[model samples]
Target: MTTLLQIDSSITGPNSVSRTLTTAIVEKLREANPGLRVIHHDLAAAAPAHVTPANFPSAHPISAAAGDAPEFAAGRAASDAILDEFLGADIVVIGAPMYNFSIPSQLKAWIDRILVPGKTFSYGAEGLKGLAAGKRVIIAVTRGNFYGPGQPTASFEHVETYLRSVFAFVGIPNPEVIIAEGVQLGPDARQTALDKALQQTAGLNAA
Candidate 1:
């Protein structure tokens, strides 16, 4: 069976546009692939802690010092589990909403866990190479104001750009993206953007 990882990091619950888009995308994928296994992680409900000196060694096992704190051990275990989920999934769907011109801190924390050096990427004499390459990534992005290409504030757009760069660095270069931007401009713009995003999700290919 194809394993799908569904991640939602919106704090707004039902009012989150990114969450709605991700749900629709997942439903579409399910319709196309039977017996799909889904593993969901709701970052808003159970947010991962930001990386600190205590837990930072989890990614670099050799750098771990002796006599670490109990909390550090627990954080390492949690990060290990998160990395395992990412490695196990054949497809990943993310609901990422823009917060302060970037992705939510909860989502960033989750990212810190998955982007381990030896696990997802590595460096060699040739250059940096990504180990996790085959998995497909689909991102559902929502921003209040317009920040797309050629927009007045496009330079401020970080959600999609950052996600693309991260995923590319980890070996998935061309992630499928569905965006619902300028939702806060007006009711009409919101509906239009939502409808367009839903249509994009409907047109997505199956795993």
Candidate 2:
């Protein structure tokens, strides 16, 4: 059976457009694949600790000073679990909302745990190579204002661009992205954008 990892980073609860899209996308996937195993991680409810000197890569080694701290040891264990989840999943669905022109800090913290050096990517004499390939990634994005291609403030759109770059660096280059922009413009615009985004989710491939 295929395992799916569903991650929600929205702090807005029911009001988050990204969260709504992700739910619909997951539902569609479930309809297509019977007995699909899903592991849901809500970053807003239980945010991962930010990367710090105490729990950095060096801390994982017993000889490192930071490794002496009990807190650091526990942090390392948690990070390992997060990485394992990503590696075990065949499909990953992320709800990414734009917060001040970028993704939520909670989401960023979760990302820091998975982008491990030798686990997700590696460097060789030839060049940098991504190890975590073959997994399907789909991101649901929401922005208050329009920041799509050719938009006036497109340069400020960091959520989608950053996510794409991160996933590509980890070996999945062409992740499917569903976006709902201009959500805060007004009632009509918000509904219109949401409806369009929901429609896009219906077309996602189950395989």
| Global lDDT scores for all candidate models | 0.90, 0.89
Ten-residue region with minimum lDDT total, candidate 2:
58-67
In the range 147-183, model 1's lDDT, one tens digit per residue, is 9989999999999999999999999999999999988
- Per residue, candidate 2 scores C-alpha lDDT tens digits across 1-207 of 899999999999998899999999999999989799999999999999887756554323332655457766767777778888999999999999999999999999989878877788988997889988999999999999999889889999999999999999999999999999999999999999999999999888877
For model 2, how many clashes? Answer: 0
RMSD of 2: 2.0
- Clash counts per candidate, in order, are 0, 0
